[model samples]
Target: MAEIRIENLHRRFGDFVAVRDSNLTIRNGDFFVLLGPSGCGKTTTLRMIAGLEIPTSGRILLDGEDVTFLRASHRDIAFVFQLFALYPHMNVGQNLAFPLKSQGTPRAEVKARVAEVARLLRIEHLLHSPVGRLAGGDRQRVALGRAIIRRPKAFLMDEPLGTLDAEFRDLMREELRQLHERIGATTVYVTHDQIEAMSMADQIAVMDKGVILQAGPPNEVYRRPATMFVAGFIGSPAMNFLPVTGPVAAGAQTIAVNGAHVTMPKLHEPLNHDRGVLGARPEHMELADAASFRGRVFGVEYLGARQLVTVDTSVGRVKVRAANTGKAKAGDTVGIDFRSEALVLFDGRTERALASDLMNGAPVEGRRAAHG
Candidate 1:
């Protein structure tokens, strides 16, 4: 187990930049996730950490030792790929023993380690099964088992569950989280899926356009995003951005959106841009009958215990998560309102989040809840 620190990490190829001025810290014995959409430089970042890809400029320190130019084989890290990269001809036990054998451990030690890993993963019955004949989930378990058998300083996983089906992926997600907790291994995982990042990561670094936009615990990133891209990328159905149409001064408690004055928490600073956007999550909004801001419901999606209701407002269309009681349907006019503490004002010009009491994690007392 070790702490991995990345400093001023930058990577370039020919005329294009793949990663830019990135700095991060993966704490010892923590499950850290690099999260973003496809080609957001998460994989490139992970490769650099694993010593598989060299950074154009920066430093990589593992366990307080500089390993910026170390070879992948000498970094003492195990990598697990999305597609299970198992030796097709080898049986499960043999695959698990290969790492120890390659490192020239005694034959008895290799056998003992193979047994330990199989039991730990609860795949003892499949130790003799051929890798080519195993199910997807079983094969993935074998891949993880092989990595775990190595006893590496840390584990670098690149979307290890990306190839599984939806239900299987969900199951594997839980399994992987539990495995990480039991082993207490330092793991750096890369994924484009927000659900996986939110549910599994102890810390998440949200990236976009080859840059780290925000990094924090899941709840902190979800509740208080650092930028418009983070707010929009980290949530399902995403955050709603309504255009601000009036001048907003420091400590202001209200703003005009489409001619209606919507109440918000007082701002910590004056708006830097003439135009701005108000951000609110779907679950934080409520449908009320008398709220000054109103909209027409045009879409209602059933989602098991909840429904995602889309309303067309004068400013923009907004999504609200409501109880699936069949009370909301298409073509209904509803008043839209949210808790003042849930709003995040962003500078439309820079697309950066503005500071506020709530955004700064202040506890404001006696705030009203949204309801219809």
Candidate 2:
């Protein structure tokens, strides 16, 4: 296993900056994920790590060895692309052995390695099947098996399950998690699917517009986002941002949001900004009979055990996820409540989180609960 470190990483296409000055440290045996929307430079970053794309200015270190100029063939890393890039003419066993054959391994060792990987991936029975005849899931397994048969130092996967159906994708996610546990290889996965990153990664890097916004454990980045962009991008329905006019109190102690007085939380560093916005996730906000803000329900969607209600409030339309209580309806005036602890304040113009300021007591004016 090897730890991958990147420093001052940058990539540019003429005047267009594909990646900014990014730095990250991927520990050994970590199932790290790069998650973001399309064209967010996630793929470009992954390709750079795989030696497929050269960085404009940066240094890549593998286990303390500089490999910034290494070619893909000499990097001792395995990559599985979105498509299952298997040769149609070769059978599963042949495909799995091709890598070892190219490296000129002994015939006995190549056969043994192929059998071992096929059995580990549960594809032993289909080892002789032609690539075109196997199902999508089987093909994907074969592709993975081929990559692992080489026993590379690290594995890089780029949305390897994007072609599978929803059900197959879900199953593959669990399978990949189990596979990672068994092998414990240092792996870096890139995907736009937040669910995959949330469930599988030990650490997740949230990216946007070629820059990494936040990096931490999945829940930390979800519950306490470092920036407004992270708060708006990581969740399912996404966090809601509301504009509020407020005054900057002494020591940044308090702020008024749309006539509602709220106390600020204490911060490690002082924030010297005035105008800011409040952010809350759908799960953090609750519907109450007598609350501060009032809104009309635009629609309600029943999602098995939970229901998602869209409300047109005085501020704006906000989505609230609640239990399936069968009480709320469309076109009804409902009150909304949120825990002060769960609320996130950000600078409206810069979109950066504000520093906390409350001394010892509860920061804001609501019940407190750990989110997520």
Candidate 3:
């Protein structure tokens, strides 16, 4: 097991900075995931920890030992790339045993380790088959087996399931989490897919634009985002934001929104600025008899269990997730109700989040924007 710590880590490529001012800690036997969009520096951060990419500044410590300048081979960590980089000519057994053999372990021990990992991954029956002909899922298992056979101090994975079909990827997510629990190794997984990170990680660090925005348990990040970037980035279908278009001040009970008179929410303190964005998740809005607003149904998506209905309101377009009762359809008029308990407010000018300490009926600063 390994306790990985990164302090003020940074990496720059000339005029462009890939990762900056990053500080994070991965405890021993923890399933930590680095999540972000492409070019957001998630992968770059992982490469640095694996000793594949040297940081421009900062330090990396493992179990109280500073190994900031160590080479990849000397780090005693296993890295699993997204694309399987196994030897095509070698069969499953050779591929799995290669790492152990490279260390010149006894022949008997290599065989024993290969067999143990193969059984653990449920790929023992394919040990003699050529890796070139294996299915994608099987290939992934072999890749994982190779890493596991070595028993490295820590495991670094960069979207190991990126190439698999959606169905298999889902299955592998559970398998990977189970494997982490069984082996109890320090793991750092990197992926752009939020579902993958949310499902498999014990802790998730959401990254963007070369910064660690928020790092916490998946539920905390989802429920309490620190900024507009995080609030909009972490949720499915994204977050619905309505901007107050007019000038705002510190205290206002009601404001004009989308050409409609809307009541403001009670915040813990008066808002610093009136002009800001109001946020609501689709799942929070519901159809009500005593609706606060009305809009024309623009689109209705049937998601089997529920229907995501988009409405064109005077203020702007709003989406609501309702039961699949099939009563609402496109072109229909519906009374929209905002769940006061589920609303969030953000700063309009900066677009930063204000929902961490507050998530409810928030005051608007100006007229509602057409698009938020």
Per-model CA lDDT versus the true structure: 0.88, 0.84, 0.81
Shift of residue 284 alpha carbon in model 3, Å: 1.0
| lDDT tens per residue, model 2, 40-156 | 999999999999999999998988888888998888999999999999999999999999999899999999999899889999899889999998899999999989999999999
Candidate 3 C-alpha lDDT tens digits along 95-142 = 999999999999999999998998899998999999989999899999
Estimate the TM-score of every prediction: 0.95, 0.92, 0.89
User: For candidate 1, what is the TM-score?
Assistant: 0.95
Candidate 1, 1-372: lDDT as tens digits: 899999999999898888999988889999999999998999999999999999999999999999999999999999999988899889999899988888899999998889889988889999999989988999999999989998999999999999999988999999999999899999999999999999999999988878988887898789887788999998988999999975689889888887778788888778855698999999988888887888889999999999999999877799999878888789999987887877888889888777778755442111110000
| Least accurate 10 contiguous residues by lDDT in model 1 | 363-372
For candidate 1, give the lDDT of residue 211.
91
**Winner on TM-score (1 vs 3):** 1
Candidate 2 local accuracy as lDDT?
A: 0.84
Model 1 lDDT, residue 185, Cα:
100
Candidate whose lDDT is highest: 1
Worst 10 residues of 2 by lDDT: 363-372
Between prediction 2 and prediction 3, which has the larger lDDT?
Answer: 2
